[model samples]
Target: MKLLLTSGGITNDSIHAALEDLLGMPVGEADALVVPTAQWGHPMCGPASVRGLVAATPSFRHFTALPWASLGVLELTALPTVGKDRWVPWVEAADVLLVDGGDATYLAHWLRESGLAALLPELHGTVWVGMSAGSMALTPRIGQDFVEWAGAPDDRTLGVVDFSIFPHLGAFPGNSLEHAERWAADLDNPAYALDEQSALTVVDGVVDVVSEGEWHLLRS
Candidate 1:
């Protein structure tokens, strides 16, 4: 399956253009959208968060009607307002799964606790698309030193890919490289340091890097 991964929100013109090129038609064309409610910046309803994002982002705002019509929406939040069974349709019927940015650690824990973690990869035709925390959640490990929105302090991740992704590394607080270096040395595995506007897409086992700035691969 194809996996489209992005660093974070496009804050630059060049980066926005690149993201549009790769994502194609904003998020409106997606077959299914799984937005973690835990990641909403504000305490809004799940559907409201989705609507808010589309409204706030010009690229996504216009496609609101299209996305709602063609795709099923699932809100995986701190707790489900709807039953977990409602998520099956989107998870099972999706050709593309669009994940929004949030807290990686919380997203990971929610997926595991709700039993969706084991079900995601089993999707026969689903193409996974992720951004920021959504991207980080797909990897086996991720740096949580920057924020602790959810889960335990020593939370181990959902082991999807055997690496930690350092999203928005250029914006990491304190010594970014030093912290990354220390994490790499401690984990003894490859770590992805994605700058803002950068992306890493993995499709059918092929990994592609796209960025307007720079991205780094740190290995212990």
Candidate 2:
């Protein structure tokens, strides 16, 4: 699997170049499916938000928003059966699956319940790009602070990645480098703190950090 995890979306030349390299083609030629389900119920989850996100990275000529929130109420057991007709085709067709940030727990719930988690491994050529909460949802567990902030019950996550991600470091009301350092100190698993200009790239299973901003890795 190929993943680009960011605190913010593509914000610099290096990140853009990395994405281009991952695509193995011009960004304009790629087809992207933007999943803004994490932003669901928020005022920013509408068409305007989609437009703004797409504008920030104008490389993809074809962009489609797949609001997964519509299926949020369905039973988790029903997801695999229902998703075949509704989401499978879209996921299979896209070259990129761009997940937007909002509430990580909310996103994780839908991803699991809607069967996206089960299908992700089958997306052979697709690039998974995540911003903020979207990035955090892919990890084994989220920080306790973030779980509390999101008003969620637990820090458990999708576990797509073995470690945890502390995003928006040094630039937010949510987190700072100092805070991340404190959090990492207590964690048994590897943790990464990333600022807006930085990203964590995973190709197959190797991890690489790319940044124009600040980032840190904590392992104990």
Best by lDDT: 2
Over the stretch 12-88, how does candidate 1's per-residue lDDT look in tens digits? Answer: 45544444454454544545555544355323225655676545445443222223326545556533455657667
Ten residues in sequence with the least summed lDDT for candidate 1: 60-69
Candidate 1 positional error at 210, Å:
2.0
| Per-model lDDT | 0.61, 0.73
- The global Cα lDDT (0 to 1) of model 2 is 0.73
Candidate 2 per-residue lDDT, tens place, 58-94, comes to: 4322122222121111222345676578767767777
Q: Candidate 2: which pairs clash?
A: none
Flag regions of model 1 displaced more than 4 Å.
Answer: 9-29, 40-51, 54-56, 59-72, 77-85, 172-175
Question: Residue 45, candidate 2: how far off, in angstroms?
Answer: 7.2
| Native-referenced Cα lDDT, model 1 | 0.61
TM-scores of all candidate predictions against the true structure:
0.72, 0.81
